[model samples]
Target chain A: MSDFLFKRMTLIGIGLLGSSIALAARQKGLVEHIAIHTRSQATLARAEELSLGDSYHKDVADSVKDADLVIVCTPVGACEAVAKAIAPYLAEGAIVTDVGSVKASIIRQMQPYLPKTVHFIPGHPIAGTEQSGPDSGFAELFINRWCILTPPEGTDAAAVDKLAQFWTVLGSNVETMDANHHDHVLAITSHLPHLIAYNIVGTASDLEMVTNSEVIKYSAGGFRDSTRLAASDPTMWRDVFLHNKEATLEMLGRFTEDLTALQRAIRWGDGDTLYELFSRTRSIRRSIIDAGQEVDASDFGRHIVEGGETRAEQLKSDDHKDTGS
Target chain B: MSDFLFKRMTLIGIGLLGSSIALAARQKGLVEHIAIHTRSQATLARAEELSLGDSYHKDVADSVKDADLVIVCTPVGACEAVAKAIAPYLAEGAIVTDVGSVKASIIRQMQPYLPKTVHFIPGHPIAGTEQSGPDSGFAELFINRWCILTPPEGTDAAAVDKLAQFWTVLGSNVETMDANHHDHVLAITSHLPHLIAYNIVGTASDLEMVTNSEVIKYSAGGFRDSTRLAASDPTMWRDVFLHNKEATLEMLGRFTEDLTALQRAIRWGDGDTLYELFSRTRSIRRSIIDAGQEVDASDFGRHIVEGGETRAEQLKSDDHKDTGS
Candidate 1:
C-alpha cells in the first residue's frame, strides 16, 4: 500500500490479517477511506476506538456498500458466510479478495456467493505469526514475504493483476498458481510443519519426564522454534485443517512415510544413513538463508514478542480492555 | 572452573565438545594446565594454533601423564580405544571422566581400562551446536544447560560432588540420574527431535512437486526451526545413535505412534483433537520462554538470516580473503 491504490478500501473482518492490511494501507497511503467490519459489535467498537478505520460496521453488508475494494480477512470457515453476507451490498466492479491461508477452500466457499461483476480473487500473503487479534499486526509483517494468488481457471486476468499489485505495494513478492498447487505447496511448507510442531510439543508437554519446568528449562533453540509454530492461533489452524483437508492428508502421508524410514534407520543403527540425512537437511537451511526467506540470528522469534509488547498497550485503551486491540 | 579446580587436566580428543570444555575450563581458570591430545595430529596442531590448551600431544598416554584430571571427549565409538591409550599412564590418585552423551556405553567401554584407584565418573554436558572442530568451541556453550552425571553405585561421593561443582562453575545445572533414565530422557528430548528434523528436511528437499528453491524461499519459521535441529553435527549425532541405540529406538517408537495419531486427526478433520494438541504445545513454548531458554516471539525461526549477516563478516574469511577485520 505504497500509494493510493484504491480510493476506498473495505476490510471485512478486522482480525489480525485485516487489521494488518488496514495498518499497512494507512501507513503507505494505499487507500483514502477504510471501512472495518466484524460480526461482533465489541470488536467493531475496539477497531473504531483504535482508529483502525474511518468507517466501522458490525454487518459486512453495511460496510462494503460502496467500497472500491473489499478484502475478506476472516478464518476460511467464516469466509463463505461473510461473502454471502456482503455480496448483496458489494459495489459493482468492486475488486474482492481474501487473505486466507488455504486458497482452494476459501475460493470454493466464497466465490459462488460473490457477484460475477465483482472480481473474486483468492490471495494469501505467506506471512503471519502465532499471535492473533487486531493489535497483533504491523505494517512490516508482509515485507519480504510471498503473497500468492490462486485464481480459478476462468479468473479475470486484469482483476488478478490488480490484486497482485495491491499485495506488491504491501512489500510482498507475488506469484500466480492454480488453487490445487497452492494448497499442495502450503501443505508441505506450512501446514505439515505446524502439525509436527503442535504434535511434538503436545507429546513433550504430556511426558512425565519432561515436565513443564523441565521442558521449559531445557528447550534450547530447537524446541523453542517448535513452540513458536505450536503457539499459533488454534482456531485459525483448526479451520485450516477443516477447509484444506485433502491436501493436508496427502502431505501428512508423505511426512509419515519419511518419518517411518528414519525410525527404521535409528532402530537398525544405520549411522551412515543418519549422518547423510542430517547433513543434507543442514544444506536446506543454508539454502533458505541464502534465498533471503530466513535469518540466521536467534532473535527472529523475539520480534514477535516485541510486536506483542507494542500490542499489549491496547490493553490501556478503554474500548478494548476486554474485546481486542 | 573457578579458583584452580585442578592443577593439570588432560583431554583425549579435542573436537567441538572437548575443545569447548578446554575453553570453558580455561575461561574460568578451572585448571592451571590443560593437556590436549587427539588421535589426529592435525587436530592437535589446530588446537595448539588456537591456543586451546597449554600443551598438545598426539599420544593420549603421553598427554595424561601426571595430569590430575583426565577427560575423554572422543566420539562414543572411540572411547575404549582412547581409554586404553591413556590407561597405563593414568596417575593413581587422578580423576578420569568423559563428556559422552550416552553414559552406560561410555562406562562399559572405558571403565575396564582405568585403574580402580582413580575416581571414574561418566558425564554428559547437554550442550553443543551443529558446528564442529576445535575452532567451533566456545566458553559459553554449556551455560544454562543441563549436565547429567551417571556415576556408578560405588563411585566416590566426594569425586562426584567435585565434578558437579565443576559443571556448576561452567554455568551448567548439575542433574544426576541413572544411566538408563538419563539416556531415555535425552532420547525423547533431543535425539528424536533431531531425527524428525532431518527426516522432514530430507523429504522436502527430495519432493518432485516442490523445487528446492521454492522450499528454501518459502521456508518461514517452522521449516527453519527443523533445519536448525537437522543441522546439528552429523558425526557426533551418528555416534550418539550408535551408543544410545535402545533409548533412541524407544523414544522413536513413541514419536512415530504420536505422529501417526496426528496424521489421522488431520485426515479426519478432527478439529477438537488438533486444537487440544496445538493448545497444549503452545503452553510448553510459553513455559520455555519463561525459563529463558526461548524468546516468546513471532517467527522465532526468522533470525537465521540475521545470524548470517554477522556471519557475512566471518564469511569474509570463508573465501580465504581474510581482510583482517
Candidate 2:
C-alpha cells in the first residue's frame, strides 16, 4: 500500500456511507488504520465479517480514539446522538466530517456536542444507490461523482483542504459551500426529486382502479423510472425530510405550484403551454449530458437486441423515428 | 426473407413510432410493400433517404391505396385529420390501427371518419425512448414490450386478431382492453408520469436561486432520472395530455393529494409516515423487476468504468452499499 496521509481514520456508523468510505480509503491507501463503529451489535459483527475496517467497535467513543480523521456516516436524525456519544474520546486536531444529505441541520445537531479542538466540516457526497448495508458498498461508488463539503465559517482552512484531499483521493470531485446553502441546493436537486418519486409511485400503487399488478406489468411506460428513487432507503429519506424541513417544504411548494399549473394546462387543452414546458426540460437533460453528469442512455440504456456493438453502431442500425405528421 | 403477412402495409406518419413499425415490419417480412406518407415533403424526403419504406408518398391517400394493413402512427392531435385523409382510400376489409398513448380520444376522433369496411383498432405500444424522429426508429423497438390494442365494442374479432398477430410478430406481448379503460390505465402508467417528469425538470430549470449550470452538473442525484422522461418529444406528450385530459387530470388530482400529505409529513417531521410511504414504494419497483417490466439496474445502469462487460457483471462488481446507518 502507498504511504498513508493519516495514521487512523474512524467511521462512526458502518452503514452504506461508512463502509463505502472505509473501502474507498483502504483501496486508495489513504489511512493506515480504519476503525468502524455502529450502534447495533449485529451490524458491527457484519462489518467485522466484511472486513470493512481494521477494528470494529461496539462503543462509539472507542472508535474515535486516536483517529486523525473521524467521519460520522449516519442518517441526519441520528447525527446528534452520534456527536454526543463520540465527543469526549475524539483526538485533538482531528477533522470531523459527515456524509449526511442535509447539512445545516447536521451542523446544528452536531456542533454542540463536538469539542472545539476538532475541526467540524459537514459534507454530503452526491452519490449512492437504492441498495443498503455494509455488503452494498464498493470502493468505486464515488468515482467521478461530486462530494460537496459544507464547512461552517471559521473552520480551519487547512482541515478543509485535508478533507478535500481525502475525498479527491477517493475519486470524488469536491466542491465546498455554506451548510445552509448546501441544504437549499440539495432540497431542490436531491430531496424534492426523491419525494416526488416516492409520491408518484405510492399514488400508482394505491390506485383502486389500476391493480398494483398491472402498474408493475406496464411500468416500462415512465412509472418505472420514478420507482428507482422511491426504492431508496426509507429511514434515510425520512430523516432527510425531517431535518431539512423548511427547505424541503419550500422546494415542494414550488414544485406543487408548477404541477398545478401543468394540471390546469392539461385540463384546459392548452397544448402549446404543455409543449413549451416539455420542450424546455429537454435542454436540461442535454446540459447534464454535456456537463458529464449524465449518460445519454435512452430508456435507461436497456437494449433490446444484445450484440457486441457500440452505442453508436446500435443507434445506426436501430435508428429512431420522431418526424411525423 | 420470410412469408409476408400482408401484400402492402401503409404507415400514415413516418415518425418515431411509424418508422419503427416500418423497420420492424421489414425485418420480420410482415409486409411485402411498405408505403410511408407524411404531409411534410421534407420529412418524406428524409424518410426516403433513411429507406424507412418501399415508397414515400406526400399524398396521404396514395400511401393507403390498396394497402391491406394501415397504421396511423402520428401525434394524438392529428388522429382526426389523418383519419379523414385516409378514410376514402383505405382498402375494403383492411385492418387499420394507430399507435397513440391516449386511445379513447383517438377512437372518438377517428372512428366516425373511418369507413365501416375497415377495422379501426386503436393500439398503444408501451415502449419508447426519449429520442424521436425518423432517424430514431429501430427494428427491435417493441421487443418484449406490451402493446395495448383498444378495439371498439363491435370491432370485427377476425380483424382484431390479425392486428394482434401483426404486433406479436413485431415482438410485442399483446393485450386487448376497452378504449376508456385503456385511457385510464395509461394515464396512471404513462401520461401522469411524463407530466410529473416534465414539471419537475422545468421547475429545476426555472429556479432562480439555483443556477441552471449547477442543477445540470449535480443532476445525478435523482433529478437526471426525471429528465429522461422530460426529454421525450414535446409534441407527442402534449397530444397525450390534451387528448387524455379527464384521465390525466384525475390521476394528477390523486398525485397532488398524496404529495400534499407527503409535504405535511415532511413539514411536521412525521418520519414514520414518510418512512412507511417510502418503504411501500420499494416493493412496487421489485414487483416491476420480478414481472420482467424493468431491469434491476441501479442508477439507470450507467456504467462509469469502461469495459466490454455485461450489465450483470458490472452490477456484480458494483454491489451497491445501501444497508448502513
Candidate 3:
C-alpha cells in the first residue's frame, strides 16, 4: 500500500469536494494527518463534527504550517481570495492542488498568490451531485470518474506524479491537459449539460398552461432526470458559470444552434428529418450503456427492460453444436 | 371485484400498450378472456410465448368477434385500419377504446370506421417505459400513473363510465378531457420532452469534437435520464408526431421561444435572469416528490453522492439561502 504517501494533507473549504477528499484519503490510507479548514467557523465546526479530519482550523497559515499537501476546494469565484489567504501558508516542496470544476480561471487566479516554493497544480474532478456541504460527500463519488489536472510549465514532474497518485487512489481516471482544453472539454461534457438541464426545468416551471403540479405529476423519466442535474447545488454551479463564462458560453451557443435546427425541422413538418435525428440519438444511449457509465433504467425504473438473454443463449448454442446459426 | 367488467376484451396491437393492458387485466381479473391480435406473426408468437393472453388471432375481425370490449392498441396511424378490420365482427353493445398517445386524431380516424353498436372512446395513458413489444410490460406499470380519456359529444355516459372504471382498476387516475385539449397538454408535457431528449442525444452524438467514449464515460444522471426517454420505440413515437402534428408543433414553438430567451440571457451573462429561472424550477421537483411520482436518485444508484441527510439538512440553513433576501 502506498498509504501515508503524505504525512499531512490540508484542505480548504470543507464542502463537498473537501469532505469527499477526506473520506477517500482516509479509506485509501493516502495520508496520515488530515487538516481540514474552511472560511466559516460554522463550516469548520461542522467538518469537525462530521469527523472529516484529524485536525480542523479556520486559519490557513497555521493549518498548512506542517502539511505536505494542500488542496483548495472552494467555489471557482473564491479561488483568488483563498489563494491569497493561503499563499503564505503553502509549505515548501508541498504540492498544492484544487478540486474546482473550472480549471483555467482558477489557475490564473491562484498562480500569482502561491509561494514560489510551492507547486501549484490545478485539477477539476468531473464528478458531483445535486447536493453540497461536508456531509454530502462519500469515498466512492469519484470512482470511475475523470479528474483532469492542468499543470503549468516548469512544474515539478515528481510533484505532479504524487498528486496524480492521490487522485488515482481516490478512484479517478486521471487525464492531464492544458488548462484551456480542460475548460473546453468540461464545457461540453459537464457545464453545458448542467446549464441546459437547469434551463429546461426553469422553462417548464414558468409555463402558464402546464401547472407546477402537472409537471411534477407527469414528470415521467425525462423531467425527473433533468431535475437531478437541475437540483445541483445552486451556489457552486452559479460560481462555475461565472468563472468559466467563455467556455460555457461557447458550448451553449453550439447547443442552442442545434436546438434551433431541430425547431426548424419540426416547423417544416419534416418527419424524415425528425425520425433520422431521433434514431441517431438512440444509439448514443447504447454507447453510454456500453461504457458502463449507465444502465437502461427505463421510465419509472419499474422494470429492468432487457431480455437478459441473446448473448448467453448464443454461448449455449455454441457449446451445443460447436457450431453456428 | 369489478373484474370481468368486460366479458371478452380484444386488443388489436400486441406492443407495449397492448401488452400492458393484458397484464394489468390478468392481474386484476378485470376481464373473462383477453383476445390478442396484431399484424405480424412474430409478435403474435412472442405474445403467446409471454402468455400475454388466453386467446390469440392474426386477423382483427376474428380477434374481436364476440368480444364485449375492444382496445385499438396499435400505433395511432393504424387506428383507422384496425377499426375498419374489427368493426364488422364486434359483438353488440361492446365498448371500444384506444391506448394511443394522441387522442384527437385517433378519435377522428377511428370514430368513422366504428360500428354504431360499439361505443367509441379514445384514451391516452400517461405512463410507459422506453421498452416496447409483448415482453416489455408488467402488471404494475400503470400503478399511480394517469389515463386521460377524450370522448366526443354524446358519447354514452355508461360507456365512458365503464372505461374509466377499467383504467381505475388498472391503478390509474382517470381524468376526462376534450380530445384537442388532451393533445395540447400532452404536447408540452409528454411529446416535447421526449423529442427534446432524442434531439439533444442525437446532437451530442453528431459532434465531431466530442468522442462517444467521452460522452459515455462522463454520462451523468442527466444524460442517462434523457436517453431513457430517447430510447423509446421509434415507430410508436414517429406515428405520435405524425398524428398529433398541430398541437405538438404549437408546443414546440413555445418551447423554442423560451429556450431562445434563455440563450440570450446566457450570452449576455445575465446571471440574475438565469438564477431567477433556475431558482423557480426547484419547486417543481419538490411538488413531484410530494405527489409520490418520483424519487431523488441523485446518487443515481451508483455511489450515494453523499450518504444520509447531511447535505440536504445543511442546505436548509445554507448562508446562500439569504441571497437576494
Candidate 4:
C-alpha cells in the first residue's frame, strides 16, 4: 500500500474535507508533492501554516500544473470556475476528480470545462465532522468510511481504477455508481437529513415558549443530535441544495408529506400509527449499526466511566451488582 | 446525602425509569426499602431477577402499602389508573411523584385520584437513552441531568423539598416550574425532535427510488444520528405525543411552517436564506456543548477510533507531527 504514490496532487480548497484529504494523503504517503489552492488568501495562509500541502498556490491553474491527480474540493457552486481555471494547466492523461456532495451537478458543471484528455471522475467521501478549516482535519478522517465515485459512461476504465485505488489507499472503501443514482441516494441519506436537522434546530430557536437557554440545557433529550448536522458548513450545504435541487426537493417533498401525516396522527391521538412508525424506524438504526455505519453506543457513548466500559458492559455491571446485592 | 432516607419507597412500574430509580436510590442509600410492582408479569419477573427493589409485589396495592414515598414510573397514558390503584394504599403524608414527560397531562390525570393527604408532584427527568427495559437501569443514568418537578398549588413544600433532595442524591439537578410550562418546554426539547426523527427515517425507509440497504449503508453521512432518537421505545413516545398533544401539535405546526419556508428557499435557490438558517443553527450546537449537555465531539462523538484516542486528541497529534516535520 505504501508503494501507492502520485508525483503531485492538487487540492482546490482547504476546508474540512479538503484539509482532511491533504492530511490523509500525507500520512499515508499517497502523494509525494501536494499543491493546495483556496480562493481566500486567509484560508490559503491557514493551510500553509498547517503545512497541509507541500506547496500553496493563490491560483488554481498553478496548483494543478504537472499534478498527476487534481481533486477539486470547493463548494458545489464553484465547481465550474475551478474546472475552467485548471482545465488548461492539467497535464495530459491526469485524473481530475472532486469531493463534492452532489455528483450530477458537479459533472454537469465541470464536464464542459475539463479537457477531453483528462479522466474526470467525480467522487464523494461520505464522511465529515461539523468542524471546518485546515486545523480541523486529521489523517484518519476517512478510515473505514465509504467513498463513492461517479464516472460518466465511456470514461476510461483505467482512470476510474486509479482514482478508486487512490481513495482505497486513503482508508476509504470505494464504490462506483451512476451519477444520477448517486444523486438520488445521497439526497435521501445526506441532504434530506441535513435539511431536516437544520430546519428543526431553527424551529426550536425561534420558539417563543422555549427559551434558547432551555433548548441548549435539555438538548441531550434528543434535539442536540440534530444540531450536529445543522452545524455543518453553511456555504457547502447551501450549494448542495442549490446544485442538487431536483433530487433534494423531491426527497424534501416526500419528507413533508410524511411529516404531515404524522402531525395528523398526533393531533388525532392515533397512538397506533405513531407506535408503528417508531417501531419500524428502530430497526433501521439496528441495521445501520449492523452495517457498521453507526457505533453501538448508548447515548452516543458519552459516559465518563473509568476502564472505558462500553454501554453493554455497563449494563452488565449493573445486573451483576444487583444480583450480588 | 447519606442521611437522606425514606422508610419505604414504592415504584409502580419496573421499566427503564422505575428500575433506574430503584438502582439509584439503593446506590445512594436514599431509601431503606424499595417495593416494585408492574402489571406485566414478565417485566415484574425481570425486575425481581435484577433485584431492582427490596420486595417485588404482583399487585399495586401490595406494593404501595405502608410506603412513605411512591413514585409512578409508568407511561404517561397509564398515570391515572396507577394513581387510582395506589391512592387507597398510600401511607398518610407520603410524597407521591411521577416521572412522566408531560407534566400537565399527568397532573390532570392523577390529581383527582391521589388523596390530599399525599403530596402529588408531577415530574419529568430530561434524560434518557433510546434503550428502555429493566435491564437498562443504572445508578449513573441521571448524573448531571435536569429533573423538573411540577407540584400543584398549596402542595406541601416540605414534601417537594424532600423529593428534590432525593433526586439530588441520585445525581440529578432539580428545578420546579409550572406544569403547563414543563409541557411546553418538553414538547420542543424532546417530543418534537423525536417526532421529526421518526418521521424522516420513516420517509427514507419508504422511498421508492432508494433502497433500504442504501440508506443504511450511507447513513454515516448524517442519517444515522437521527436514527438514535427514532430508535427510542415506541410505547413511551406514543404516550408522550398523546399526553402532550396541544404543545406537541403547536411545536409541530411551527416546525412544518419553517420547513415549508426552507423548502421554498431551496426551490428558489435562495442561498442567503439557507446560509442564514444554517449559520444560526450552528451556534445552538455550540451552546449545547457549553451548557454541558453535549460534547464538542464532531459527529456526536461516534468516531470508531481503534487506538482509544479521542477525535480531538487525534487532531492535536496530527498538528503536533506536522509542526515537528
Each candidate's DockQ: 0.27, 0.62, 0.32, 0.51
Q: Supply candidate 2's per-residue lDDT for B190.
A: 90
User: What lDDT score is found at residue B209 in candidate 2?
Assistant: 78
Instruction: State the fnat of candidate 3 relative to the true structure.
Output: 0.34
Question: Residue-wise lDDT of candidate 4 within A71-178, one digit each (tens)?
Answer: 988889999988888898899999999999999999999999888999999999999877777777777778788999999999999899989988999888999999
Scored by lDDT, model 4 comes in at 0.84
User: Model 2 lDDT vs. the true structure?
Assistant: 0.83
- Give the higher-DockQ candidate: 1 or 4: 4
True contacts kept of each: 0.51, 0.77, 0.34, 0.66
Q: Residue-wise lDDT of candidate 4 within B1-325, one digit each (tens)? A: 4465799999988777887788889988888899988888878888988888889999899999999899888888898898888888788999888888898889889999988888888888887777787877667778888999998899888889989998898888899999999888888889999998999899999988999999999987888888989988788889999999999999989998998999999899899999999888877877787777775466655553333325454442113211100
Question: Backbone clashes in each candidate structure, one number apiece?
Answer: 16, 26, 2, 0
- Candidate 1 lDDT over B31-111, as tens digits, reads 999999887777788889889999988767789999989888877888888878778888887889888778888888988
- Per-residue alpha-carbon lDDT of candidate 2 for residues A78-172, written as tens digits (9 for 90 to 100): 99999998899989999999999999999899999999999999998998877677766668778888999988889999999999999999988
Off by over 4 Å in 2: A304-325, B304-323
Could you list the iRMS of every candidate? Answer: 13.4, 2.9, 6.4, 5.0
- Expressed as tens digits, the lDDT of each residue in B75-193 for candidate 3 is 77788888787778878889888888888888889888888887888887887766666666667767778888898898899999999999999989988989887777777678877
Q: What TM-score goes with each of the models?
A: 0.88, 0.95, 0.89, 0.95
Query: Which stretches in model 1 have alpha-carbon errors above 4 Å?
Result: A1-3, A40-50, A208-212, A298-325, B301-325
Residue B288 error for model 1, in Å? 1.4
Write the residue-wise lDDT of candidate 3 on A1-325 in tens digits. 5548999999888777788889989988999999987878877877888899999886777888878898888777788988888788677898889988888899889999888899899987877766667767677777777788899989999998999998898888888888887676677667877777776777677667667666776676346667767766666677778778888777766776777776676667667877777666666666666665654344423222122212211211112210000
Model 1's i-RMS, to one decimal, reads: 13.4
